[model samples]
Target: MSIDRRRFLCRGAALSAGLLLAPGWRAWAQSAPMLDPAARQARAVRYVEQASAAQDDPAYRAGRRCANCDFFSAGQRCSLFPEHRVSPDGWCMSWTSE
Candidate 1:
Protein backbone atom coordinates (compact mmCIF):
# COMPACT_ATOMS: atom_id res chain seq x y z
CA MET A 1 0.00 0.00 0.00
CA SER A 2 2.94 2.41 0.81
CA ILE A 3 5.99 1.64 -1.33
CA ASP A 4 8.05 4.78 -0.65
CA ARG A 5 8.30 4.21 3.10
CA ARG A 6 9.22 0.56 2.69
CA ARG A 7 11.78 1.31 0.01
CA PHE A 8 13.48 3.96 2.11
CA LEU A 9 13.63 1.67 5.13
CA CYS A 10 14.95 -1.19 3.03
CA ARG A 11 17.70 0.91 1.55
CA GLY A 12 18.70 2.21 4.97
CA ALA A 13 18.73 -1.29 6.37
CA ALA A 14 20.86 -2.59 3.52
CA LEU A 15 23.32 0.26 3.87
CA SER A 16 23.73 -0.37 7.56
CA ALA A 17 24.10 -4.07 6.98
CA GLY A 18 26.80 -3.54 4.42
CA LEU A 19 28.61 -1.12 6.67
CA LEU A 20 28.55 -3.62 9.49
CA LEU A 21 29.75 -6.36 7.17
CA ALA A 22 32.72 -4.31 5.97
CA PRO A 23 34.83 -4.73 9.08
CA GLY A 24 34.08 -8.43 9.09
CA TRP A 25 35.56 -8.88 5.60
CA ARG A 26 38.91 -9.78 7.17
CA ALA A 27 37.39 -12.95 8.51
CA TRP A 28 36.51 -13.97 4.99
CA ALA A 29 39.94 -13.30 3.59
CA GLN A 30 41.47 -16.48 2.30
CA SER A 31 44.29 -17.84 4.43
CA ALA A 32 47.49 -18.96 2.75
CA PRO A 33 48.93 -22.40 3.20
CA MET A 34 51.43 -22.97 5.96
CA LEU A 35 54.18 -23.09 3.36
CA ASP A 36 56.01 -19.86 2.57
CA PRO A 37 55.89 -18.18 -0.84
CA ALA A 38 59.28 -19.63 -1.80
CA ALA A 39 57.96 -23.08 -1.03
CA ARG A 40 54.79 -22.33 -2.98
CA GLN A 41 56.80 -20.94 -5.89
CA ALA A 42 58.89 -24.10 -5.88
CA ARG A 43 55.79 -25.99 -6.98
CA ALA A 44 55.24 -23.66 -9.94
CA VAL A 45 56.47 -25.61 -12.99
CA ARG A 46 58.72 -23.23 -14.93
CA TYR A 47 60.97 -25.61 -16.92
CA VAL A 48 59.32 -28.70 -18.31
CA GLU A 49 60.69 -29.86 -21.65
CA GLN A 50 64.40 -29.96 -20.87
CA ALA A 51 66.75 -31.75 -18.55
CA SER A 52 69.63 -30.26 -16.67
CA ALA A 53 73.08 -31.15 -17.98
CA ALA A 54 74.67 -31.22 -14.57
CA GLN A 55 76.61 -34.30 -13.56
CA ASP A 56 73.81 -35.28 -11.21
CA ASP A 57 70.55 -34.16 -12.65
CA PRO A 58 67.74 -34.58 -10.20
CA ALA A 59 65.06 -34.60 -12.88
CA TYR A 60 63.84 -38.09 -13.60
CA ARG A 61 61.27 -39.71 -15.86
CA ALA A 62 59.17 -41.35 -13.19
CA GLY A 63 57.34 -40.11 -10.12
CA ARG A 64 58.06 -36.64 -11.42
CA ARG A 65 55.06 -34.59 -12.36
CA CYS A 66 53.22 -31.41 -11.42
CA ALA A 67 50.48 -33.45 -9.79
CA ASN A 68 52.65 -35.83 -7.79
CA CYS A 69 54.85 -33.15 -6.33
CA ASP A 70 54.52 -31.92 -2.72
CA PHE A 71 54.98 -28.36 -3.84
CA PHE A 72 51.72 -28.67 -5.72
CA SER A 73 48.91 -27.51 -3.50
CA ALA A 74 46.58 -30.35 -2.59
CA GLY A 75 43.46 -30.31 -4.81
CA GLN A 76 45.35 -27.86 -7.00
CA ARG A 77 46.29 -28.70 -10.57
CA CYS A 78 48.97 -26.79 -12.46
CA SER A 79 51.25 -24.34 -10.70
CA LEU A 80 51.55 -22.15 -13.76
CA PHE A 81 48.23 -20.28 -13.70
CA PRO A 82 46.97 -21.79 -10.44
CA GLU A 83 43.62 -21.03 -12.07
CA HIS A 84 43.87 -22.18 -15.76
CA ARG A 85 44.69 -25.50 -14.10
CA VAL A 86 46.39 -28.42 -15.81
CA SER A 87 47.15 -32.10 -15.29
CA PRO A 88 50.30 -33.94 -14.21
CA ASP A 89 51.07 -34.92 -17.81
CA GLY A 90 52.52 -31.72 -16.79
CA TRP A 91 56.20 -31.30 -15.91
CA CYS A 92 58.50 -28.39 -15.26
CA MET A 93 61.63 -27.40 -13.39
CA SER A 94 59.18 -26.13 -10.84
CA TRP A 95 57.66 -29.55 -10.68
CA THR A 96 58.50 -30.37 -7.01
CA SER A 97 56.89 -32.51 -10.80
CA GLU A 98 57.53 -34.83 -7.41
Candidate 2:
Protein backbone atom coordinates (compact mmCIF):
# COMPACT_ATOMS: atom_id res chain seq x y z
CA MET A 1 0.00 0.00 0.00
CA SER A 2 1.21 3.57 -0.82
CA ILE A 3 1.84 5.92 2.11
CA ASP A 4 0.54 9.49 2.42
CA ARG A 5 3.23 12.16 1.50
CA ARG A 6 2.34 14.40 4.50
CA ARG A 7 2.60 11.50 6.95
CA PHE A 8 5.89 10.43 5.34
CA LEU A 9 7.54 13.80 6.01
CA CYS A 10 6.80 14.40 9.67
CA ARG A 11 9.58 16.50 11.23
CA GLY A 12 11.77 14.81 13.91
CA ALA A 13 9.96 11.53 13.22
CA ALA A 14 12.20 8.58 12.31
CA LEU A 15 11.75 6.71 9.04
CA SER A 16 13.32 3.37 8.15
CA ALA A 17 14.60 2.91 4.63
CA GLY A 18 15.08 -0.86 4.65
CA LEU A 19 16.69 -3.75 6.50
CA LEU A 20 20.24 -3.19 7.90
CA LEU A 21 19.78 0.64 7.71
CA ALA A 22 19.77 2.74 10.87
CA PRO A 23 16.69 5.04 11.01
CA GLY A 24 17.68 8.72 10.76
CA TRP A 25 15.32 11.60 11.41
CA ARG A 26 15.31 14.61 9.02
CA ALA A 27 15.64 18.11 10.52
CA TRP A 28 16.95 21.60 9.70
CA ALA A 29 19.77 23.22 11.72
CA GLN A 30 21.87 26.37 11.59
CA SER A 31 25.43 26.02 10.29
CA ALA A 32 26.88 29.02 12.11
CA PRO A 33 27.56 29.11 15.84
CA MET A 34 25.30 31.44 17.81
CA LEU A 35 26.98 34.74 18.79
CA ASP A 36 26.98 36.17 22.30
CA PRO A 37 24.78 39.28 22.59
CA ALA A 38 27.54 41.11 24.49
CA ALA A 39 30.14 40.36 21.82
CA ARG A 40 29.37 42.15 18.54
CA GLN A 41 30.70 44.87 16.26
CA ALA A 42 28.85 48.12 16.75
CA ARG A 43 29.35 51.28 14.65
CA ALA A 44 28.32 54.63 16.05
CA VAL A 45 28.97 58.19 14.86
CA ARG A 46 29.34 61.21 17.16
CA TYR A 47 29.33 64.21 14.79
CA VAL A 48 30.74 65.85 11.61
CA GLU A 49 31.08 69.46 10.44
CA GLN A 50 33.07 71.83 8.26
CA ALA A 51 35.82 74.14 9.57
CA SER A 52 35.17 76.70 6.81
CA ALA A 53 34.81 79.48 9.39
CA ALA A 54 38.55 79.08 9.93
CA GLN A 55 39.23 78.70 6.21
CA ASP A 56 42.49 80.60 6.65
CA ASP A 57 43.55 78.46 9.60
CA PRO A 58 46.94 76.77 9.13
CA ALA A 59 45.35 73.36 9.82
CA TYR A 60 42.59 73.72 7.21
CA ARG A 61 43.58 72.07 3.96
CA ALA A 62 41.70 71.01 0.80
CA GLY A 63 43.12 67.48 0.54
CA ARG A 64 41.14 66.29 3.59
CA ARG A 65 38.48 64.45 1.58
CA CYS A 66 35.80 62.34 3.30
CA ALA A 67 36.27 59.48 0.86
CA ASN A 68 39.57 58.83 2.64
CA CYS A 69 37.93 58.84 6.08
CA ASP A 70 37.32 55.62 8.03
CA PHE A 71 33.65 56.43 8.62
CA PHE A 72 32.66 57.87 5.21
CA SER A 73 30.62 55.37 3.20
CA ALA A 74 31.47 55.11 -0.51
CA GLY A 75 28.14 56.84 -1.30
CA GLN A 76 29.41 60.12 0.38
CA ARG A 77 26.70 60.39 3.04
CA CYS A 78 28.00 60.27 6.63
CA SER A 79 25.93 58.60 9.35
CA LEU A 80 26.80 61.16 12.02
CA PHE A 81 27.64 64.02 9.68
CA PRO A 82 24.27 65.54 8.74
CA GLU A 83 25.82 67.84 6.17
CA HIS A 84 23.66 67.12 3.05
CA ARG A 85 26.24 68.56 0.66
CA VAL A 86 28.82 66.42 2.50
CA SER A 87 31.62 68.61 1.24
CA PRO A 88 35.09 67.16 1.03
CA ASP A 89 36.17 69.95 3.40
CA GLY A 90 33.83 68.61 6.10
CA TRP A 91 35.15 67.08 9.31
CA CYS A 92 33.49 64.85 11.87
CA MET A 93 34.30 61.96 14.17
CA SER A 94 32.65 59.77 11.51
CA TRP A 95 34.43 61.68 8.77
CA THR A 96 35.66 59.47 6.00
CA SER A 97 35.26 62.73 4.07
CA GLU A 98 38.17 61.88 1.84
Candidate 3:
Protein backbone atom coordinates (compact mmCIF):
# COMPACT_ATOMS: atom_id res chain seq x y z
CA MET A 1 0.00 0.00 0.00
CA SER A 2 1.07 3.58 -0.57
CA ILE A 3 2.42 5.56 2.37
CA ASP A 4 -0.39 8.06 2.12
CA ARG A 5 -3.04 5.37 2.38
CA ARG A 6 -1.23 3.74 5.29
CA ARG A 7 -0.98 7.05 7.06
CA PHE A 8 -4.66 7.71 6.49
CA LEU A 9 -5.60 4.32 7.90
CA CYS A 10 -3.39 4.87 10.91
CA ARG A 11 -4.95 8.23 11.60
CA GLY A 12 -8.41 6.76 11.28
CA ALA A 13 -7.54 3.99 13.73
CA ALA A 14 -6.12 6.48 16.17
CA LEU A 15 -9.17 8.68 15.95
CA SER A 16 -11.51 5.74 16.42
CA ALA A 17 -9.53 4.49 19.39
CA GLY A 18 -9.48 7.89 20.99
CA LEU A 19 -13.19 8.35 20.53
CA LEU A 20 -13.97 4.87 21.82
CA LEU A 21 -12.04 5.54 25.00
CA ALA A 22 -13.50 8.93 25.69
CA PRO A 23 -16.34 8.94 28.20
CA GLY A 24 -19.74 9.80 26.68
CA TRP A 25 -18.29 9.82 23.19
CA ARG A 26 -20.51 6.98 22.03
CA ALA A 27 -23.57 8.73 23.44
CA TRP A 28 -22.61 11.97 21.78
CA ALA A 29 -21.96 10.21 18.50
CA GLN A 30 -25.33 8.53 18.61
CA SER A 31 -27.23 11.63 19.66
CA ALA A 32 -25.49 14.33 17.68
CA PRO A 33 -27.31 15.49 14.57
CA MET A 34 -25.75 15.52 11.15
CA LEU A 35 -26.06 18.52 8.85
CA ASP A 36 -25.99 18.67 5.08
CA PRO A 37 -22.98 20.25 3.44
CA ALA A 38 -24.88 23.47 2.75
CA ALA A 39 -26.08 23.67 6.33
CA ARG A 40 -22.61 22.91 7.58
CA GLN A 41 -21.19 25.60 5.37
CA ALA A 42 -23.79 28.05 6.61
CA ARG A 43 -22.83 27.27 10.18
CA ALA A 44 -19.15 27.56 9.40
CA VAL A 45 -19.69 30.82 7.54
CA ARG A 46 -20.85 32.42 10.76
CA TYR A 47 -17.27 32.25 12.00
CA VAL A 48 -15.66 33.24 8.71
CA GLU A 49 -16.66 36.37 6.88
CA GLN A 50 -17.85 35.49 3.38
CA ALA A 51 -15.88 37.64 0.99
CA SER A 52 -16.08 38.31 -2.70
CA ALA A 53 -13.16 40.73 -2.62
CA ALA A 54 -10.01 41.13 -0.58
CA GLN A 55 -11.27 44.53 0.59
CA ASP A 56 -13.40 42.66 3.08
CA ASP A 57 -10.34 42.05 5.25
CA PRO A 58 -6.61 42.68 5.41
CA ALA A 59 -5.93 38.95 5.45
CA TYR A 60 -7.60 38.43 2.11
CA ARG A 61 -6.13 39.18 -1.27
CA ALA A 62 -8.47 39.84 -4.23
CA GLY A 63 -9.16 36.14 -4.83
CA ARG A 64 -8.36 34.41 -1.56
CA ARG A 65 -10.92 32.05 -0.09
CA CYS A 66 -11.40 28.69 1.61
CA ALA A 67 -11.14 26.88 -1.73
CA ASN A 68 -7.75 28.45 -2.30
CA CYS A 69 -6.57 28.69 1.28
CA ASP A 70 -3.90 26.46 2.74
CA PHE A 71 -6.20 25.08 5.39
CA PHE A 72 -8.80 23.90 2.89
CA SER A 73 -8.90 20.23 1.92
CA ALA A 74 -10.89 18.00 -0.43
CA GLY A 75 -12.62 21.12 -1.81
CA GLN A 76 -15.11 21.19 1.05
CA ARG A 77 -13.67 21.24 4.57
CA CYS A 78 -11.17 23.45 6.37
CA SER A 79 -8.35 22.04 8.44
CA LEU A 80 -8.59 24.97 10.81
CA PHE A 81 -12.17 24.10 11.65
CA PRO A 82 -12.89 20.40 11.12
CA GLU A 83 -16.40 20.38 12.53
CA HIS A 84 -18.16 21.70 9.44
CA ARG A 85 -17.97 22.22 5.71
CA VAL A 86 -16.64 25.65 4.72
CA SER A 87 -17.74 27.77 1.81
CA PRO A 88 -15.27 28.39 -0.99
CA ASP A 89 -16.00 32.11 -0.68
CA GLY A 90 -15.68 32.20 3.10
CA TRP A 91 -12.92 34.18 4.75
CA CYS A 92 -12.01 33.67 8.38
CA MET A 93 -9.61 35.18 10.88
CA SER A 94 -7.50 32.07 10.42
CA TRP A 95 -7.34 32.35 6.67
CA THR A 96 -3.91 31.61 5.25
CA SER A 97 -3.22 32.26 1.58
CA GLU A 98 -2.06 29.21 -0.30
Best by lDDT: 3
TM-score of 3: 0.45
Judge candidate 3 against the unseen true structure and give its global Cα lDDT, from 0 to 1. Answer: 0.60
Off by over 4 Å in 2: 1-55, 82-85, 88-98
Higher-TM-score candidate among 1 and 2? 1
Question: Candidate 3: deviation at residue 71, Å?
Answer: 0.4
Local accuracy of candidate 1 as per-residue lDDT tens digits, 1-98: 65798899999999999999876653432232322223445345343422332214365555565567665544444445453333434555654521
C-alpha lDDT values of all predictions: 0.49, 0.39, 0.60
Better of 1 and 3 by TM-score: 3
lDDT of each residue in 1-98, candidate 2, tens digit only: 98788777753255334322432211111222322212222113222345343345454455554556665543344444323334344543433432
Highest-scoring model, TM-score: 3
- TM-scores of the candidates are 0.32, 0.28, 0.45
**Candidate 3, residues 22-96: lDDT per residue as tens digits?**
767545443433223345554454345466634655555666667777887663666765665556776655667
- Those runs of model 3 whose alpha carbons end farther than 4 Å from true positions after fitting are 1-49
Q: Model 2: what TM-score?
A: 0.28
